[model samples]
Target chain A: MKKRTILGVRACTWVWLIMMGLTLVTYLIGQLGLGGISASLTVLAFALIKGQMLGDYFMGLKRISGFWRWPVVIWLFLPGGLISVAFTLVG
Target chain B: MQAQAVAEPIRYPPGDLAIWVFILAELAAFGAFFGAYAFTRMQHVELFNHFQATLDRDAALINTFALITSSYFVVRAVASIRDNNSQGCVRWLMAALVMGALFLIVKAQEYAHHIDEGIRLSTNTFYMFYLSLTFFHFMHVIMGMVILAAVAVKAKRGGYSATEHTGVETGASYWHMVDLVWLILFPLVYVMK
Candidate 1:
């Protein structure tokens, strides 16, 4: 598995930092008690993106062409979409 | 907004094919559980939100960070072994193991708090789901750490090389799956209301 580097730092390092940042953002949202469908969607959006990055970069699925790469992405979006719908029905 | 790949050869999925199959199965099981939670919460919004407030979000936030960082450490381990640096690989694995241990410790504290409150799986709907879902994931972290330990011991024994370190990838893939699940689990269980 060839790891891509950016300006000397490994790509995984960058991904890790971004993931941490996103986690904090979600935490802040929770801490602020932001109640609404939008806030829930925002949190789920962050989580799904983090899952995608973990699958692609950390799991090394990015380097692969097809099949395997799609499953994780599908796994991510499938539940995410369903969960979002579930939340929206809170109308 | 992502960068292009460095135009390397088509690498197969980092780990064995069998592992991916197992991973998909695990994901399906988790997906079902999450779906159940979402629907159940929909039916009992007040109950869910009330119990969700009782949870310690700070500990969950810390655990989320711990798991993400540990996943990165595993990525480094894979890279190190790809360079045939078994020692570096071992070091990274050990770092990952430490992070895993940290996650467990924090989670254990959360569980202790719950137990002290006399919370049980039969306590209420929210507590049942909370305890069952989280404890299930907790066992996974424990199992993931054990897998990483085994891989680190193998690396220290010089059992892998640049071309033969699928074992590392396999372990990493498993760990990342655990992390991936937590990525959803944290926000789903702890944050979203």
Candidate 2:
């Protein structure tokens, strides 16, 4: 296999493991009665981490053409801003 | 002259633009639904918080694991197809399908339990949104399975190659989208007390 392919596989495995681990952490935190802003931030952080991993590895955005990469970045960022605005207004 | 020039470049079919477009539209729809959920939760913060406490965290956590595992297999399926490992791709896709089915089954049981406890959709505004959003997600899971089954059948017939496996790629992308939405929804609905 090419070096890039090997790297891709390894990165994907790491992302998957990390995502699963984060889910467990989220559950443990939830069970501990961490349900206020702390829990919300924790969930958002996990989601962001997982989202970045999925985008970079699974979606192959990291290897995408330059023309496509910026659009994806914009798509990902827009949601964060929107969610933040929603939370600020509501929370 | 030397060994002469190369012939015409081999042309592959277009990439999976159709599937990407579908995913974009689906994301937009989910965005609208999420915005609505956020807005409503803002309005009824106390009621929403109360409903959040009633959710089974363990069940939600299990479902999160299931979806994430399915997504991992989906990424594997795409990689296998790229390597021209048709059988491996089929195996991964099948695993994803099974996980999707398990998620739905668990969701059904949870719903049944809620209904038995007299927690119908009309119970409250919070319940209304909860049932509606989750049922919509459930439908997406069913659709994703159908797409995966189709891809699995094609893979079994050796229909995809390293150069022309757009179908598998597109199906996997859709499956990931479903998983992504659930990632957001799980925390928003179940953990955001």
Candidate 3:
């Protein structure tokens, strides 16, 4: 149990670090004033990945099974897809 | 050798099942709002782009980092409770609370800047969405923090154990959702052109 706890903590810490780095990258991309289709797509993709990491790892959804698994994926892709489409239309 | 009990598939939906329903409803609301924002943006592309420039991207970025870190700390708190480390869990939850507070502070500053600039929900379509969406999310952050504080207080009283700590996971789930919403919100509003 102790070993598992230690490993879990380590894994979470690593995930946190990765998320922080990705956020910095996202910030840089946004600050560069990336506009239009490609830019929106790129940022939205990053957002999707980041949101997935949080839901799957941080929320521990990855460890579970059954119908619970799909909501996170749906949540990410649905609004994300809609927003992406919206950006494309406007961009 | 004793036969091992047959393994069963894990149940769907984590935490309280009720929370999933609430989460779905909340997502739907936000989705509708995002769609509306996008539709409105399409109608007034020039105006949306123009006002988007006036937003403090830097502050939004800081708030983003804050929420992400808060979610991470919530993960740690849940992990600690799963290990029956009540004190450790409390510490992590408190740390997360600090991050949540930091998020609110930064958001407040952004709001102050906007208010000083005569921004309000009635300002325009863009400002309308900006203020409504962000402030609605801002309130969620506060609510998430309150939930964390309650969980932390309970943990401090040794209200959980290794075999039973659903509250921690429940609070963490909500916090993660809050973080997740911002992940979409930031790009859609602050970054997407």
TM-score of 3: 0.94
Error of 3 at B50 (Å): 1.1
lDDT of 2 by residue, A1-91 (tens): 4424344656677788889998888788777878655567767678767776776677666666545554445554566556556666665
Q: Rank the candidates by TM-score, best first.
A: 1, 3, 2
lDDT of 2 by residue, B4-39 (tens): 786653222124777767777777777677768777
Q: What tens-digit string does per-residue lDDT give for candidate 1 at B1-193?
A: 8988687656468778788888889899898888888888899999988899999999999999999999999988988999999999999999999999999999999999988999999999999999999898899899999999999999999999998998899989989999999999898888898
Minimal lDDT window, size 10, model 2 chain A: A1-10
Query: Interface root mean square deviation of every model, in Å?
Result: 1.7, 4.1, 1.4
Collision pairs in model 1:
none
What stretches of model 1 exceed 4 Å from their correct place?
A: A1-3, B1-11
lDDT of 3 by residue, A1-91 (tens): 6443354557777777888887788778878887889978888898889888887888877767878887888878877878878778766
lDDT of 2 at B32: 72
CAPRI verdict on model 3? medium
The whole-model lDDT of each prediction reads 0.90, 0.78, 0.85
Worst 10 residues of 2 chain B by lDDT: B6-15
Whole-model alpha-carbon lDDT for candidate 3: 0.85
**Residue-level error in angstroms, candidate 2, position A60:** 1.6
C-alpha root-mean-square deviation, candidate 1:
3.8
Model 3 C-alpha lDDT per residue in residues B7-96, reported as the tens digit of each score:
777775447777778887887888788878887898988899899989888988888999999898888888888888999999999999
